[model samples]
Target: MFRVLALALVLSVSFAGVVPNPATDGDRGEYVTLSVPENTSLGAYTLADGETTVRLPDRTVSGLVALAADPALARNLTDARVVRVPGFPRLANGGETLVLRRNGTVVDRLTYENAPESEVFADGGWRPLGATDFQTATASDVAVSAFALPDAPQRVLAALRGAEERVLLAGYTFSSPRVARVLAAAADRGVRVRVLVEGGPVGGVAVNSARVLGDLAAAGVEVRVFDGPRSRYAYHHAKYAVVDDRALVTSENWKPGGVGGHATRGWGVVLRNPAVADHLAAVHAADSTWRDGVAWSTYRANATFQDGAPATAAYRSDFAAWNGTADASVFVTPEDGHQTTLGVLRNASERLLVQQVHIDDARFLNATLDAARRGVRTRVLLGGAWYVREENRALVERLRTTARDEGLPLRARVVDPRSRFDHLHVKGVVTENAALVGSLNWNHESVVENREVMVQLRGGAVADYYARVFRADWRGGVWRLPLCVLAVTVGIVLGAAGVMWRRVSFSGSGRSGVPRRVPRPPSSR
Candidate 1:
């Protein structure tokens, strides 16, 4: 009698939501759902049951189906689709693996366990059966922090202030008075400070780089303009800094909007890794010493302005002390093949989450499409700025067709133009266990013909943090919430739910491709 009651209780609660055994699934076997709204039908979709497979009508079907042990439990899905497969293997109460495929192409592979209590997980956040540990990040020897616009200036300043030794900075443009003042202050303190900015106006647009370069040069900061015409690359568009063995990589220019005053939405990463710092510093050295680069004093003869003011410091930090360990490395283009970023996308077995400013390179787009073809779920959040180039807007249509006609598991969305942030200028990629963050974009010019930099981080607290940030950004933001809010929210949810956690598992092999390599450009501007 007791056994009967217990079985009844389990059955009663099973249909409430997730499968009962949530803990048994292995790391790569993380479960997910392709939510089917009411009355919607997945045309030509099929569900498999052991050696047998059943095909649902090309038309719509209404019902809930579990890839688990009990098919009856599906009746509870008032809003989910029911793919009826007679003789479908019952989902094990302990745990079961379910793979969904279409036309022999894998769609999703989910491993689920029965839950001890009733609850739901949505939008990457969890809610309890009735239930939350919120805490702050403690300082560590090797730490990483992410900063976005309207607040990047504060963090950028903090990074600058924390520098105790030499500072090397390379940017496409340098017009931010706030950042200029900070650089001047660093120089004044007897710290070796050197800067490199673009030498000439790009695409007929007059740049204030010459004036900013002159001011920094006058302030005793070693400043030079990159001689792009003599170099193999078309431009020195990479924006990054190396200070005292710490690396600051960003996808923003050094203007009031880009880094200082936070007038634009951008992404920045601070990595306390000696190897990464050394590599970036080397890149800066190479560009600074380019054969054709003219000293700021010499370039000032063609300046657009006679002078500029010392930049004021407004950068701050809401992040905890730097003390997170990461397996981080620097990847520079026109030197290295920019393989690190491509490798992350090619190796994604389960998912690829990216926020890119533009996508025009065929090879880059092909790699992403190939991953989706192999059953890797892909989501690309694109910037909505009107200036994002017409070619990219067309690429979006191509990607959409690739997903629809080829039945690939891919989705792309343009950010709402009305968001608080001006432009989504972030170039970031998050895989199951790694992340790529930096100034490299997915375009022919960026990957093949221009200088770029990025930090490739694999498995660690830092990678996890990046993945969380990507997920949140994928969901449009309210803008004012600082990074701490995400950390606290997760803590509260976990603390509230007495639920046992399971590890996520992923699987996939890596592929390699050669990007168009350009020799070092000529040495004159």
Candidate 2:
């Protein structure tokens, strides 16, 4: 008892100015806490795998309290940033509340009976800050906002144009002149652009990386290729970017074929904060499992690292990682096995928000249902328009049925440019107040075949933005199709996987067609 109180006292004094914030910023994003007034009920706010239920007319509105009470809400929180809703000190309202914090200090708070954006609700343009009611500030304000891409691709390009410093991109393949130009321009202007490509050992995605590195190098970018290894696990597949403290951890490799395999589209987060950026950098640093580097003789091999820079990133002591505990929690499998992630999400106290390009595992489904039935809100966002695989269709049906039975929310999204493969292979979880990200997937390969990378980020801006993006995807962010239509259309969509599968399998053979062994130089010649 003394220990707990003593810890609190220490925290209070050391962070004397730092209040017991109801809000926290996770590596992925920031989450603000808003206390509803006594007896006022909150409309439900649902995201990919989590939900937060507000009880109105409450004596307090601690984001921490809400998340702690519900596992579903807690998983996504990762951090709780505390803010006092003014007037009622329990309620805040209005656009005027935008100034709630000035120069990083909370000042005036707004009190209102209803949401100030009521007028903008009709348009598809309204961006929710947190929940309805002028409660706490938005998840975005606490974090660097994604380029509002769902609105326009130009917005994405515009975001690229805004880069000022360093850019580290890791992807499976990249072959877009436009993208290359963008990286080149960023480099020419003095932005450091380092690219780690998954090449050779893994289906020659390295070849793809080589192509981009060559171009970027000519364009004056600092590039490097990490040749993936084939040891006891699968090849590496991680896509992300770190521009200073802002980062992007993605399921899609930023390539001409973004997220490969149309039966599913990939999803990624444009992290606009330090925590997430640093966390991702560490993850990138730890991919020692992918150490097979190949020299691309055909493509531009000039994308070599400068001699002064470190040849490889030094692995930071995992113990020294600064993941805070703010009622928000993050746990890593801490092993090569990705299946452990299922246990993490399934054990949530409030909600679990899961987004993936592909989710058809029986264990995965069982876990979701199990968590939901236990009174934990469980929501899942799966691939919709991009994939036409029969197996994927079956998984979709299973997810839908489970959602129906458990009263959990399950959604599907169609990645735009459905013709090309979309890479939505991110494996992360937002359970109540915690968020985790990595290269793990809800697939057989992820569990046994792949040696994946995953990280647990605590209390920051990245987690909240991650929560918001998950919410947006769950609410049918880009997919305009009805549920049935999406499922039905799955049978006859682009058919890229089917065609590609047939093309490769038919052209290749075994035995006599075996990879020829280099003639042993007359071992005894």
Candidate 3:
């Protein structure tokens, strides 16, 4: 009947390329149109919900059309090609798949309503729009970018130079001279620059954080020290900044080797959401309150070089926020309770991609393993630097072997330290439709003990952008095993040095009480 034909027309036209119009209320199902192929015709389409199938009209007409199942919906899309489908029973809202068939063969399909909320659809695969996609452009309200090594420094500087108002920075360490000078300059120009640094030592590196802080202080930057007990979290491990109204979170310290120079690989995001910026500012304010906080000069006088920083207050946001069409969720460690990161891994139904500088958390490890066991295709990329502990490598190997035994599609690769950079410092995760980015590392301390910040980005350009980054790093920039064995060799060498020092110390020194060998006077003195 005409109703069947009309319904078919609606099916073909409704989803050709519908994009939500952010100018209107987001949840009202309002949408705009994108150009679809002009010559294409609706051959044969079917809408199926559970057990019912409704055959639509097979039409071969093209050109501008107007469509709406309801009058109100029709009015909103008056400018678009409209097809009036009548008597089409309301499709089940939760589970429905639209199948576009050509000559009885399916050409395209969309399965939606898998989550509790409305999903954003884009020409690019379903994912979130990242800062990189909107940094200098106006495509969307949210944007994100991922920079690795040599490229990161320049982008970071660009962010700093672009700031016009206040700059709030919190880090586990700050040792890059170039970055330091930039902060100084920003402060010199009368920008209210406040820096909160972990008042502790960084692992495996000689920390000159005191010197860095002193230089910034001398330049009029308000510098504060965060020690854990005096602060709230066990360690201030987050590396993030809120400049003007834009926010950036990265998995690198300000050390020259990590974020400034191309010596180590890392990932970062520049967010334009005011909600995110305000939340981070609030975190900075709370962490700045610990009575034990000391001036850079005072802390420097009594500092001992070591890894980790003092505990400080953390920034916790109540809920994930959205900007126009993009969805962003901010999570703070020791508070948000790993909801943002773990939720992505747990909810993955089809694919999961994880790239991290390190991974030792058993919960995260088990989640990935379980996801694979459940038939979800899982890929893991780990850091393969010389300094990477052998145990971490063993952990990855165990996962791979176990998955293989269980007949699961699980694979892992470690980035070659010798390739372009010394290590993979970027920590990120991507599911079928969501992506997570920020300073969070895949470890217990980062999740429960230390302060960390991460953003869970739902479907849009941002998620898509990071998914590409993860894929590239996995395919081109990855190396398989044998590097972990090399790490063991490095560990042995360090152990040998320790043994040699011990031998020399105990050989004849006798705790500095060895009797001096009184010279046997040349036989007849």
Best by lDDT: 3
Please rank every candidate by lDDT, starting with the best.
Answer: 3, 1, 2
Model 1 earns a TM-score of 0.59
TM-score of each: 0.59, 0.46, 0.59
Tens digits of per-residue lDDT for model 3, 1-525? 999976645544334432232122432333322223455555454444346445544455566443234536535433455554443334433445545444555545655543222223445333211100111111234555444443446777777775778899888878777888888998888889999877754453245666677888989998888753324456778888988877777778877766675455666667777777887887777666544355676766766664444222111111122223456666777665466567789999988988887787878888888889888999888887666757558867887788778888999877554344555788888888787777888878777667777767677455666666667666654333356788998778777766765665556734578743443222224
Model 2 accuracy (lDDT, Cα): 0.44
User: Which 10 consecutive residues of model 3 have the lowest summed lDDT?
Assistant: 128-137
Q: What is the lDDT of candidate 3?
A: 0.63
How many pairs of residues in model 1 come into backbone collision? 37
lDDT of 2 by residue, 1-525 (tens): 999966633322011011112232321122223333333222222111112223222233322323223334333422343322222122122211222232233322322233332111112222222211111111323232322122222323444665787776665555545667888888888887766555433334444445556777777765554442222234445556677766655454454334222222333434455655655555544442222333334224443322111111111111111222222211122233534466566667776787765764567767777777777766665555434345566766776776777576554333232222223344667776556665566777665544344544435444564676566555532324555788777755546446654565566556787743332222223
Question: Model 1, which residues run further than 4 Å from truth?
Answer: 1-142, 201-209, 303-323, 478-525
What is the RMSD, in Å, between candidate 1 and the native fold over all Cα? 31.0
**Order by TM-score, highest first:** 1, 3, 2
Output the lDDT of residue 171, model 2: 56
